[model samples]
Target: MKVLLLICVLALTACTKESEELRMRVQQSIPVPATMSQVLNRGILYPTAGIQVTGVVRVVQLSSGKQLQIDSFSITPGPDLKVYLSQNALPGNHLNLGNLISNNGHQAYNIPANTNLSAYNYVLIHCQQFNHLFSYGKLQ
Candidate 1:
């Protein structure tokens, strides 16, 4: 009986450690006024390679400025994941929006005022440390 209890405790500890490593929090929360913000373009994310992602990404025009909003998002968690506005499916010549706030839930990132929205046709979720493209959505 004592041995069984010890094994259960060990299993619980391993699960806790894994969850801690995968957990991520919002880095920035940019609020867009609901009445003033307009969604200029929107797209549904498609996973790249084997990575999994589900969400809708939106290019929002706000009275204060422009921003990228990810709504109802969930992704396979990984290290150094970042958000980018790119000219293609890849990251070359892309605008680094910022680190993704979390692997799940709604989040927003401010886009620089000088960025020409027309120049970017896709939104990318990338892993900087590993140079992996996790997912992307074509703005339409």
Candidate 2:
């Protein structure tokens, strides 16, 4: 009985640590009255799920760096998917925001401080498993 309790405690601690790594640390949200661009994603290498990959991609400039917010966002979930801000709307030339948080709804990802927002004009949903671009939004 004691051994079982010890195992449970260790498992819980490991899970807690993993969850902490996934959280984004953000400070200060400097909002622009309106989003600079709104976009829609269409599946690449195939037709995206008909649900309409849609959302507003806004920039919330922060003290540490820029936070790219996906507001009113929705998409079909895929394996090993991730978010990115890119110039060419392709997979490689992008600032990887991290693993995607959801198939729909609002979320925020950190944009590196070195990134030039003017050059990175689009946000992409990319599948790391298949090496495909799931969808994209062209920043207006």
101: Cα error in model 1, Å: 0.3
Give Cα-based local distance difference scores for all models: 0.87, 0.67
Q: lDDT, candidate 2, residue 95?
A: 84
Q: Please write out the lDDT profile of model 2 over residues 51-139, one tens digit for every residue.
A: 35767766765555567777766677788888888887677788887888777766667667677778777777889888877787777
TM-score of each prediction: 0.76, 0.62
User: Pairing residues by index, what is the TM-score of model 2?
Assistant: 0.62
Q: What is the per-residue lDDT of model 1 for residues 3-108, given as tens digits with 9 covering 90 to 100?
A: 9999999988884343433443221244433535789998999998788899999999887789899988999998999999999989998999888888998888
**Of the candidates shown, which would achieve the greatest TM-score relative to the real structure?**
1
Instruction: Give the RMSD in angstroms, all C-alphas superposed, for model 1.
Output: 6.7
